[model samples]
Structures are given as structure tokens and as C-alpha cells.
Target: MFPIFNIHNVLLLVLFIISALIFDNFRHVNLEVIKSFLLENIQYIFIFVCQFILWYKTGKTEKAISALSDDIYKLHKTFQTETEKKEKAISALSDDIYRTLETEIKKIKTDILTLGETFKTDAKKAEKDISIFKDDVSKMCETSQNETKKIEKEIKNEIKQIRETFQIKIKTIEKYISILNVNINQIRETFQTGTKKFEKDISALKNDISKIRESGQKHSSQAGSNLSLTTNRISTIQNSGYSDTETLRSDFIALVDQRSKRETRGYFTPMLHALTEEISLSFS
Candidate 1:
């Protein structure tokens, strides 16, 4: 059998004995026994009371520490949540900034490309225009050179024709001078051979010849002046780079007509009359 007097049983028996003793004292009214029992267990009772007070104080302290730990944990969790929110806001703001910058950069690149294309087109157009201008200048210069050569050739031919005509007129004037000299020699011979009547006839013949010579000289002078004026007009026209043959012809014809009219009225008719009287006198 197991031992019946274990620690729990012994404690129970002690508690029962103490209870009976208190009961018996209370019933018999024994104050001294009661006082003696209390004195004997005083240390045990004081120790029990002190242990209970310590347990209560330890429980209260544990509760206060738990509540403080809960409050600290709550505060830490709130801080973490606020930190996460701030991080999200910063990330969102960074994304927005990056997107804005990227869009602006794309637009700038597109504009730069467009500007480059425009410059290239303008450069090509300018090159074409410059080429055309150079071609035009070359053509104009060639045309001017051709025209100048043609004008020079025409002027040379005109001068040659004028010179030929002038040479012919000079030859005709020399022939007339020879004829006048022959006539003057014939009059001198007649004057040396004749008497008073012959002297009168000779003087009249000399006067007639003098008049014819004066008229011939005047006609020659007028012809020379007209020739010089025509030459001057031709030179003026050539120097001015004009070529109007029709106008020159008209002017020449008018001058010739006027010269012919003057010669007929002033010299030719009088000369014919003088020649006829001289022939009649010579025959008589």
C-alpha cells in the first residue's frame, strides 16, 4: 500500500487540528489558550500575508507592462503604415516627372527632325535657283557677243561702200577740173591772136568762164559739206548701236533731191544758156 501520510494529508490534518482547537476554545470561553496558539503560529501567518501581498503587487506590475508593450507595438505599426504611404506618394511623383520629361524630349526630337528636313529642301531649291541664274547669265553673254560681232561686220561693210562712193566722186571732180583747164587754155590762145572786137569777145568769154568756175566751186563745196554731214550721221548711228537702213535711205534720198533741185536752179540752166550763146558766136 502507498503511504497514507503524504504531504497533502499532513497539511489537511494540521488545518483540521487548528480549526478544532479554535472551536473548542470559542465554546469554552478560554482566552489564554487562544492567545497562546496565535503566538505560536505568528511567524507562519506573517509569512503567508507577505507572500499574498507580493503576489498581488507582481500581478499588477505584469498588467502594466503588458499594456505598455501593446501601446508601443501599436505606435510602431502606425509609423510603418505612414512610411509606406509616403513612399507610394514619392514613387508616384517620380513616375509623373519621368513621363513628362520623356514626352517633352520626344516632341523636341520631332521638331528637330522637321527643321532639318526644311533646311535640306531649302538648300536644294537654292542650288537649283543658282544653277538657273548661272545658265541665264552665260546665255546672255553669248548672245551679246554674237550681236556685237554682227554689228561690227555691218559697220565695216557700210564704211567700205561709202569710201568707194567717195572715191568715184573725187575722180569725177578731177575730170571736171581737167576740162576747165583745157577751156582756159583755148581762151588764152584766142586772146593772143585777135583784135579789139576779139578782145571784147575774149573778155565776155572770160566773164562767162569765171561764172561757171564759181558755180562749179560752190557746187563742189556743197557736195563736200553734204558728204561730211552724212558721214557724221552714219558714225553717230553706229556709235549709238543703231541699225536703221530704211531711215538712212530716206534721209539720203531727201538730201539728194534737195541737192539736185539746187543744182538745176542755180548752176545747170545758167551753164546751158552760156554754152549755147558761146556756140552761136563761135559759128558766126
Candidate 2:
């Protein structure tokens, strides 16, 4: 009814026709004769049409299924290739990261070792410097002590020499004083004798007495000036802290010799000698 041309429909129509032809002569003929008639007059054209239709539908369906399977296989291959590439990239990145970390760690370790060595070297240098400083200080202290001892010994020797020189000067001064006393006594005795003989030689005795007095005055003044000059020299030497006793003694002796020379050349010495000769002449 719906224009059916399938193999099953054609097959059904052929069976109906064969059944109709066989039933139509069923009372007047045998069954074998009817089947022979159907075989000879059957429509083969319908069977051919049915087989062509079936083959055409099956070929189209197989082509569609094959094409779909090929597309699915291509998609699977692409996904697998992308996955492998991603895994390789990740593996490479991991290796690079590990190598970088290892290099950095090694560099840090080397730096730490170098720093440790530097610190050790600095510590040793500081210790050596401290030892040298201590030695220098010790040497300075020893030298200072030695210098102090030398200065002390020199001062003691100077003091001893000064004392000996002072003693000698004191003895010389005492002797000079004794000689002056004896001369003064001799002068007094001559004056007393001259006074007792006043009428006989008054003018000559007066002249001699005046000359003696003048000489004494001049000698006293000269002695006083020399004593003052010597005192000033001694004071200057003491104030200056002169340490050389031999030099001091030599200067003192030079001063004394100069004074002796001055006295020998002065009027005082000749006047005193003339007075002594006059007294001897008077007695003669």
C-alpha cells in the first residue's frame, strides 16, 4: 500500500501468485503439474530488483561506518602525540631545574668554605699582631729601666766629687784666714813700737803707718770684690745644676790662679813688701 518494493514484499507476491495458479486447477490437475507451470512462468524481474536495492543500501551503510571509524582513529592519534610532547617538555624542564639548583648549591658551598678560610686567616693575623705589640712594650719597659739606672749612677758620682771639692776649698780658705791674722798681728806690734818712739821719728813713722793703712784698705776691698765674684760664680753653677765635678774644680783652680796673678801684679803686694823692708831697716 505504501509502494513497498523490498525483497520481502516481492517474495510475498510471488508466493501468492504461485498459490493462486495452483489452486485454480487443483480439481482438474495434479500438484506436480501445477508446480511445473509456476516455475516456467515465474517473474524473475522482481527478484532482480529486490537484490539490487538491498546491495545498494548495504554498500552505502558500510562506507559511512568506515569513514566514521577512520575519523575516530585520527583523533586518537593526535591526542596521544600531544600527550607525549607535553611529557617530554615537562621532563626537560625538570632536568633543567635540578641542574640549576645543583649548581647554585655548589657555588654556595664554595663561598662558605672561602669565607671560613678568610676568617681563620684574619684571626691568626690578629693574634700575631697582639704578640708583637706585647713584645715591643716589654722591650720599651726594659730600656727605660736601664736608662734610669744609668742616670742614677751618674748623679751619685757627681755628688761625691762635689763634696770632695768643697772640702778642699774650705781647707784653702782656712789657711788664707790664718795667714791674714798673722800679718795683722805683725802690723799691730810695729805700730805700737813706732808710737813709743814718737819724738824721735814721728814724721817717717806717720808716713809709713798711713801707707800701711792705705795698702790694707786696698787689699780688703780687692779681697771683698774677689769673694763676691767667686760667690756669684758658685751660685750660678749651683743654679745651673752642673753635673761635671772635674770641670767645676778646674774652673775654681783657674779662678784662684787668676786671683794670685792679680795680687802679685797689684800695688798691695809691693806696698806690703816695702813696709816689711822699712821695718827691718828701722831696727838696723
Candidate 3:
């Protein structure tokens, strides 16, 4: 009743044929024929099953291969994107570092140039100041030399004046000494004249005393004749001699006091020496 071309119908027909053949040949055929036929049928069935399984598995494998390829392509895209971003960041950082270094180098160059100019200016100022200092020192030295010369000239003038004053003092002292010598000689002559006159008066008094003694011895009866008159005359002569001696002493003392007052001033040593010599000569 089924179609013979259909797979189910063919499987049922083959099973029925196998059952009929088993039933018919089971008694007649030997065990060897039965085994041969079963082996042949089993081999054909095994081959058909293997072919069917392989066909279905091949389709599944192809679908899995396509999905795996898609996943690999997506992973490759992500990795490329991440690598590009990292490379860009690294390049930007490198550029910033290069720019900063350039700025720093420029600043350093400018600072060096400024410092060099300042140093040059300072050196020029120092040279000018040193020159001014040298000029001032030279001026001071010249002024000092001129001042010293003026001082020396003043000292020389003072010394000359002092020498002239000393010479004047010496001349004055010489004049005083000469005046003292003349006065001393005059006093000496006057003293000698007074001494000689006193000696003569003393001699006359001695003669008169001898004469009075002789007249008294010879003329005892005429005593009042010239006795009192001779006595008065002798007394008068003695008074005159004493007054002259006092006058001579007073004159000598007054002359010495006058010379001392006039000549001694503050220069007494030489004057005292000359006066001592004159006094010694007068005394001798």
C-alpha cells in the first residue's frame, strides 16, 4: 500500500525481505550463508549511517567557523584602536617636553648675556674709581710736600730771629760789663785817694799829740794856753776822717746795689762772677 520510492517504505520493504529470507533459508541454508548475508546488510547500513552523520556535522562546522572569524576581526579592531591612542599620547608628551626644554635653554642664554653686560659695566666703573683715587692721592702728596716746605722755611726764620736776639743780648751784656769795669776803676781811685788823705791826717794827729805831750812836760805852768785848742782841732780832724770813711763805705755799697739792680735782671751768674772778682781785687 506504500510508495516504494519513499525512504520509510524502502526501509520497511528491506526489513520484510530480510524477514522472509530468514524464514525461508533458516532451515535450508547453512549457518555460513546466513552470516554472510547479515554481514553484507550490516555493512551497507553502517555506511549509510556514517554518510548521513558526516553530512550534518559538516554544515555545523562551517557555521561555527564563520562565527569564530567574526569574533577575531572585532578583537583585532579594538586592539588597533587602543594602540593608536597610546601612540598619540606618547607623541604629545614628547612634544611638550621638547618645548619646555627649548624655553629653559632660551632663558638661560638671556640670563648669561645680561650677566656679561653687567660685569663689563662694573669693570669700567671700577677702573674710573681707581683713577680718581690715584689723582686724589697725588694731590694730597703734592699738598703735603708744599706744606712741609713752608713749615721748614718758617722754622728757619724762627731760628734766625732767635740767633739775632741772642746776639743782641750778648752785646747788651758786654756793654754792661764795660760800664761796670769803668765804675769799678773810678771807685778804686777814689778809695785810694781817701785812704791816702786819712793816712796823712793820722800822721798829723800823731805829731800834734807828741807836741802836746812835750809842751805839757815843758810848760806845766802854762797848761791852758794851746791845750784845749789843740784838743778841739784833733777832735775835728778825727770827725772829718770818720765821716769820709763812712761816705766811702756808703758810696761803695750804693754803687754795688745800683749795679746789681741795673745789670742782674735774670742774668746773675756772669754778673755775680765779675762782681766777686772786683770785690776780691778791692779788698786785696
Candidate 4:
């Protein structure tokens, strides 16, 4: 068997022997004679048995004595000694464990304290950052509100001024309309008179031009005999520049006619609108 089984068997044998001895000693409860005889040697036998049993049980010291009193004293001494030794060893072990536990607890406490301090610092920084952010946001909101109010005030003022100016411009346009109505009446009368005069002048000029063209061409064709007329025609064209003067007059009249026609045909509306708009915008 293993050591554990061997040790258990030995313990069992010692217990059996103790049981047998106790039984033998207690048998015949009424025998006073046997009790006295065994009394003198009883301590010895019991000490021997106790020593043997104790040795088998736990390897304790033997309690050898001349008397029961001596045996008891020796057992007491052995018990005190063994108990003291165990107590000393246990005390040492407890002190070691206590010291180790104390060190670990202190280390843990220090680590916890460091973490607490770090957390505190970070919390303070977070609080400060939040406060700053709040302040910045508040300031931005205030500035935005102030700017909005300022812009609103400016816009209101601008709108009021625009309304006033628009009213003034309307009045000014009404005055110009009155003046334009008068001018339009005058222009209508002038157009009637100018139309007749322009038509008469154009008719006269056309007749003159036709006559000159006819005379000039006929002179060129009869170059052999009408040398004098040809000479006069060329001379008139060069000497005083009469042909150039006539062409200039004709071009002027043509320009006038084109202007009149352009106006009559509503081609001058764009110019009239631009002029009126320019006058109206002068207020702004």
C-alpha cells in the first residue's frame, strides 16, 4: 500500500491495542484486590502504552516518571514545550503573511490613489474645456444675435430710404410725364409741318437731280458737238465744287428722311426708353 495507507493501518493497530488495554483494565468492576495490585504498576504500564501510542500517533515526547504526579508534570512540560514551538512557528508565519498582505494592500491603495488623482485632473480639465466651450458658444451666439440685430436695423433703414426714394422718383416721373405730354403735342405738330416741308423739298431736289443727270448724260453722249456743255459740266464739277456741294445737300436731306422714317416706324423707341430710364435713374 501507499504511505498513507500504511500510516492509517498503524494508527488502527495502536487504537486497537488501546481499546484492548482499557477493556482489560476495566473488566471485573468490583475487584478491589485486582485494582490495588495494578495501581502500583498502572502508571508505568499506562506511561509505556501512552509513549508507544503517542509515538505511533504523532511522535510526541515520552512522559517517563516515578509517580503519576511526575508523569503528569512531564506531560504538562512536553505539551507546553511543543505548544510553544508551534505557537512560535505559527506566529512567524502569521507575521510574514500579515506583512505580505500589508504591502499588497498598501500598493493597491497607492495605485488607487494615483488613479483617483489622474481622474480628478482629467475631470478638472474636462470641466475647464467644457466651460471654455460654453463661453465661446455663448459669445458666438451673442455676436450672432448682435450682428443679426444690426443687419436687421440696417436693412430696415435701407428699406425705408428706398421707399422714400421710390416715392420721390414716382413724383419726379409724373412731372416728367406731364412735360413729355406737352412735348409730344409739340412734336406731333412739328411732325405734321415737317412732313409736308420735307416732301416738298425732296420733290424739288429730285427734280433738280433728274435734270442734272439728264443734262450731264446727254452732254457726254454728244461729246463731238456739245463740247461746250461737256466743258461746263466738268468745270462746274471742279471749279467751285458745285457737284460736291449738291451731293452733300442731297446726303443731308437723305439723312433727314431716314431719321423721320425711323421715328415714324417706331425704330426710335429703344432710344426714347433709354433716355427716360436714364433720367429716372438720376435720382438714385
Candidate 5:
């Protein structure tokens, strides 16, 4: 058989653990009243103490959750910051592209204007030169069209690249979001568990405090009763002493008066009277 140990602690912790595991935060009404008595106090103190220790662990887990949340938040902010940077770069690139497009258009317009101005100046001579120049113009037009197509292709490719990059970023963000949701769920569970533990501990503490208060009250009442008894005994002694002193005073007064009538009652008699008066005054 197992030897009996610190029964109070054992009972306290055992009851708490059993109750927590069995009830899972369910009510145990009047546990306080039941445990407030000596037997129950001894039983539940261990459970109460254990809960107090777990309270620290619960707080630590909460802190870890908070730290993880901070990390996730920082990751998200970094992603946003990088995205903003990419967008700004794309904006600048787009502006440059638009400016190049405008320049090309201006070049084409100037070329067309030059050909028109020359064509009207000399008809026959111009026709002969125009025939020769038409070949050059056709070649230039072909080259220009090819260059424009190439630029358009390049722009389309760049846009496709940007779209692909954006898609990848979106996927990453979703991944981070998924992780965040999981962490939050875990933290929530921890909080729920921790809350129940706290309740369990609080219930046990209330029981202990109640018992201690009852003990204090009992002790105080006993002490007061004892003090009253002592006071009464003291008063009895004082009364008895007073009565005895009065008897002694009566006898002494009778003896003095008799002595005064019998012979010489001297100045010492007054001294004795004064001494009695002083003694009474000293007591007062």
C-alpha cells in the first residue's frame, strides 16, 4: 500500500486535475462550500497549486502566439512594401514607353511632311525623283512597321511577365494568410484552455481563502472570550482588594481615635493621616 504523504496537497491537486479532465470547464456547483471544510481543503489545495503553475505556462503560450502574429504581420508588411516598389518601377517604365511611342509618332509625322512638301514643288522632276524615292519610302515603311511590331511584341511580353509575377505574389500572399489563420486558431484554442484552467484555480483559491477566513474568525472569537474571562477575574480581584483595604482603614481609624482619647496623639498622627491621603492619591 502507498504511504500517506502530504495529504492536503495530494488531495487538492488530484481533485483539480480530475475535475478539469472530467468536466472540461463544466460547472461543479458548491465545490467551494464543500471544499471549504477541512477535508475538502486538504483534498483540493494540490489541485489549486497546480493550476497556479499552469497559469504561467498558459501566459507563455499566449506570448508565443503574440510573437508569431507579429512575425506574420511583419512579413505581410514587407510583401506590401516590395509590391509597392515593383508598382512604382512599372509606372516609371510605362512612362518611358509612352514617351518613346510619342517620339516615334513625331518622327513619322516629320517624314510624311517632308515627302508632301517636296512632291508639290516640282511635278515632272518630282515624279521622276518620286519614282526613285518610292522604293526608299517602301523600304523605310517596311522597316518602321517591323520595328513597331517588335516594340508591340516586347510590350506584350513584358505585360505577360508582370501578370505572371503578380500571380506568384498573390499565391504567396494566400500562403501567408493560410499560415496566419492557422496560428490564430491555435492561439484561440490555447486561450480557451488557459481560461478554463484559470477558472479552476480561482475556484480552488476561493475555497482556501474561505477556510482561512473561517479559521481566523474562530480563533478571534475564542481569543475574545478568553480575554473577557480574564478581565472579569481581574475585576473580582480588584473588588476584593478594595474591600480588604476599607476594613483595614476602619480598624486603623478606630485605633487612632481610641489612642487620642487615651493619651497624647502627637503630630505623627497627622503625618500618618497625610500618608494615607497620599497613598489614596497615588492609586488615583
Candidate 6:
């Protein structure tokens, strides 16, 4: 009973206890009275205490689980962001490389076209020289033939060098492409592995949550059943106490009546018995 009072209300608690005793003339309370009071009040107190404890524990567990889930979610989101950034960077690099290759290819084409135009101009100049030196037939013909052969050799050398340069550029582009493919494959593998790991972690978290919920429910059901059983026992005991008290009052009244009559006592016995019966009935 004293435990039922809060520390801050100790004065009020003391006053209430004193009043109860004062009104009851300090009845030197019996087990039956205590049991009846507990039967009426203890069930509610027990239920409230149990529910509060369960709610507190469940709340804490859910909070912890929620925090853990948030952390995992944040980590997964960060990973995805990082992966996207890396992919964008790789894409930018590939685009830059492609642009550079295209520029190089365009420069090669321009150089080849300029070389062809120079060869054409040189051939036209040789033809004009041949017409002008028509008077020196044998000498002019030999000189023109030598010049034509020299021009053809120079053109062949230039064409060979251009072809070699183009082949080297092609090889370089192929190497870059191969390297890019390898990098892409590696990135994909890493992403897949990370996805699998996160999935496993999420599954495990879900299982733990399910187990916690099941355990909480089981404990709640057990507590409810135990509380029910206790209430029933208290009710049975209270009823039994009431019947016994009634029987005792009746027996005491009969004994008093018999004794009073035997001793030729006064009219007080009937009135006392009636008052006692009324008080007992009120208590019951």
C-alpha cells in the first residue's frame, strides 16, 4: 500500500492512510480484507505495469531496428550514388576518347586529300613542261620520264607512311576500347556483388524483426493468461472469504441469542446482531 504512493505525494499519502485508519477505528485488518482490496484493485495495476513494460521494451527494439534499417538504407543509397558517379565519369572519358579519335581520323583524311591535290598539280606542271620542250625530243622525254618515276616513288613512300600512321592509330583506338570494356566488366561485377550483399543484409534484418515480433506476442499472450489466472484465483478466494464471514456472523448471532435467553439478558442482543449483520453485508 505504501509502495502504491509516489514519493512526491508522500504527505497526501500519509493523510489518506491515516484517514482510512481513523474512519475504520484501526480495524487491525485481516487477510480477508486485504485479499478483497487486492482482488478489486491489483488486477488493473498488474495489467498496467505489464503493458507499460512491454510497450517500453517493444518501442526500444523497434527504434533500434528502425535505426539499423536507416543506416543500411543510407549506405545502399550512397553506394548507388557512387556507382552512378563512376559510370558517368567512365562515360565522359569514353566520349572524350571517341572525340579525339574522330578528330585524328579527320586530320588524316585532310592530309591525304592535300597530298593528292599536290600530286595532281605536279602532274599538270610536268605535262606543260613536256609541251614547252617539244623541240628537244629525246632529251626532254628522258628527263620527263625520270621526273615522273621520282614523283611516283615519292607518292608511294608518302602513301605507305600514311597507311602505317593510320594503322597505328587504329591499334591505339582498339587498345583503348579493350581497356574500356575490361573496366566496364569489372564495374558491373562489383555492382552485382554489392547488390547481393545488401540484399542478404536486408533479408537478415527482416528475419530478426519477424522473430522479435513473434517473441513479443508470445510473451504478451503468456502474461495475459497468467494475469487472468491470478484474477480468477483472487475472485474465488474473495467469494470464499465472504461466505465464511457470513457463516461466522450467523453462528455468533445464534450463540449470543442462546446465551442471552439462558441468562435472561436484555433486548440489546437482537439489535447488536442486526447491526453486525448489516455491517457484514455492507462489507461483503
Which has the greatest lDDT? Answer: 3
Most TM-score-accurate candidate: 3
Error of 6 at 132 (Å): 9.4
Itemize residue pairs with steric clashes in candidate 2: none
lDDT of 6 by residue, 212-249 (tens): 55677568876566556655655664465456446555
Model 3: clashing residue pairs? none
lDDT of 3 by residue, 17-58 (tens): 866876886878888987887787997868767855775676
lDDT of 4 by residue, 1-284 (tens): 13555654676788789779877877866668667767877988788778667665453222222355687889999999999999999999999999999999999999999999999999999999999999999999999999999999999999999999999977865665565456556544654564465456546656655665678855655544455555564454343333333443344344335444443325435544453344334212
lDDT of 4: 0.64
TM-score of 3: 0.39
Cα displacement (Å) at residue 20, model 4 = 94
* Native-referenced Cα lDDT, model 1: 0.66
Model 3, which residues run further than 4 Å from truth?
Answer: 1-141, 220-227, 242-284
Off by over 4 Å in 1: 1-127, 184-195, 198-284
Kindly provide the TM-score of model 5 when superposed on the true structure, using C-alpha atoms: 0.30
lDDT of model 1 at position 9: 53
- Native RMSD of candidate 3 (Å): 28.2
Clashes of each: 0, 0, 0, 0, 8, 0
lDDT of all predictions = 0.66, 0.67, 0.74, 0.64, 0.65, 0.67
TM-score, structure 6 vs. true: 0.26
Q: Write the per-residue lDDT of candidate 2 for residues 1-284, one digit (tens) a residue.
A: 22468655676688669658757767698879868866875667467567667866775786688888889999999999999999999999999999999999999999999999999999999999999999999999999999999999999999999999999977876776565556546555755655355424446545645655567756887656655665565455433322332333344345345446454336345555565455444433
**Per-prediction TM-score, please?**
0.26, 0.28, 0.39, 0.29, 0.30, 0.26
